[model samples]
Structure formats: C-alpha cells, structure tokens
Target: MPVDFTHPWVGRTVIYTAAHPNARPEQGIVTSVNVEARIVFVRYGAGTTSKATSVDERLQFLDGSDLILWK
Candidate 1:
C-alpha cells in the first residue's frame, strides 16, 4: 500500500525494526514530514547518542514491514 503522507505524522511514535533479525528495534518520534519528497525524519537514540534517519531509507517506505507506527 502507498504511504499516506497527508497524515500529520510529526510527534507520533514509531518503532523501527531493523531488517537484520539480530539488530535491536529502535523507538523514535517523528520529527519532520516532507510530503513532496515522501520522506519522514525520525529522531531516535539512547543516552547522549541521539540520532536521526529518514524513515523512507530506514524502513524502506514500509516495504520492509519494519516500521510499527503507534497512534
């Protein structure tokens, strides 16, 4: 299914499970939405090592089924 970029995803929490089963899942909050680019930026990390990644690349636009969005 195509992603619905029209939704206000910012501030929503999302779980990102890496493609590799051995990798731990990361929980993050949506930081930004770029509908034109079809990219969602997420901020996630532990302690002082905060980081961000484009959801489209990290989750493959949901094609990998690695993202669990929480309302």
Candidate 2:
C-alpha cells in the first residue's frame, strides 16, 4: 500500500536507526511507517504488494539516522 505522507506516519513508524556506533535499531510495526527523509531512514521499495522485506535487514543502524516513536 502507498504510505500516506500527509498523515501522521512520521513518528508512528515501525523502524528506528542508531545514533551512535553501538546503538541498535527498533523494528516495531510494519504497517505504519513513511518513506521520507526526516521520518524515514531507508527506501528499498515502492508501490503496493511490494516484495516483503524485513525492516531489521532493509535498514541499517548507522549514524545520522532518525528515530521512531512508539506507544
């Protein structure tokens, strides 16, 4: 499905990148994340019925990435 960019998906994403070198990432829910720069950390696919890829492996936990806020 196409991610609603104008909606509230930025902080409600299912993934988070590491700030430091040793920090880890959080791959929470896969149905609520956007593919932008500020809120998103990676863009490995597009469009509906996209090839299922794990967030844990699709995105890298490196420096200069954003964080994901969950409830």
Candidate 3:
C-alpha cells in the first residue's frame, strides 16, 4: 500500500485526505515521488509546510482512494 511511484503522479492534482473522514480535503498538486522511501510529496500552497505527504502508517498510501476517485 506504499505510494505508487510507478504512476506518473507528478504535476497531477490531488485531494489531501485527513484522518477524520468528514474533515475538509485540501487540494494540491503532486510535486515529487521518492521511490526509494515510498513517499509522495505534494504542494498545497506557497509555504514552507505546504509540501505535504500523501502517505500513512509508514507503508500505506493515503491517496490511493483519492487517485481512483479523481480518475
């Protein structure tokens, strides 16, 4: 369930999911994919902490459902 770097994820728009299902989902664009560490970096806005991650539990892909939902 790690981030699927095999997909051309960079530059693609995505919805950043929160732990609470009802919480608002922040929208962002994929910036980088670290295949070595299985981390997918996303930029939500122009700020230092804007580069968020689309991962969870160290080995799970938090945006997998988002990818399918958006697709």
Candidate 4:
C-alpha cells in the first residue's frame, strides 16, 4: 500500500522493525515522507546518544507488519 505523506503520523516519533528476522528495531522521529515513492525518512537516536542517524525506510501499513508507528 502507498503511504500518505500528510498523515498525522508524519513528524512523529516511530519505531521501525526491519523485515528481516534478525534485524534490530530502531526508534526515530519522522523527518520526511514521499507518498508517491512510498518512502519515509526518520531521524533516530537524537538526545539518547551522542551520535544520531537518519534512515530511509519503505512504508508498510499492513497489520502485524515489520515497520510501525511508535506510541
């Protein structure tokens, strides 16, 4: 499914779970969104660590899916 760039979830904090079984989860703030491209960029590890990072991820809206919005 395609992502909605204007969704309220954009610019919020979220946790991302990789589709791979062994991948570790990440927490970050949503930086940008591209509905047409189905991509979301997140800026993670801010204030929690000295080094912060941003990651580009594919949007997945399916229930019980890999990536999800963090409450």
Against the true structure, what is every candidate's RMSD? 7.4, 9.8, 6.9, 7.7
- Model 4 has an lDDT value of 0.51
Candidate order (lDDT): 1, 3, 4, 2
- Distance from true position, residue 37, model 2, in Å? 7.4
lDDT (Cα atoms) of all candidates against the true structure? 0.56, 0.39, 0.55, 0.51
lDDT of 4 by residue, 1-71 (tens): 45455766566666666679898766666655544444565666664322122233533332324443432
Error of 3 at 65 (Å): 4.4
TM-score of each: 0.54, 0.24, 0.55, 0.47
lDDT of 2 by residue, 1-71 (tens): 35443545333334444457886655533333434422332332242332233333434334434343342
What is the RMSD, in Å, between candidate 1 and the native fold over all Cα? 7.4
In candidate 4, which residue ranges exceed 4 Å CA deviation?
A: 1-7, 47-71
RMSD of 4: 7.7
Per-residue alpha-carbon lDDT of candidate 3 for residues 19-65, written as tens digits (9 for 90 to 100)? 77587666766766666454567777564443646354222234455
Regions more than 4 Å wrong, model 2: 1-15, 33-71
Task: Encode model 1's per-residue lDDT on 1-71: one tens digit a residue.
Answer: 33443567665676676777698867766666655445566777553333445445555332334443443
For model 4 the local lDDT of residue 46 reads 60
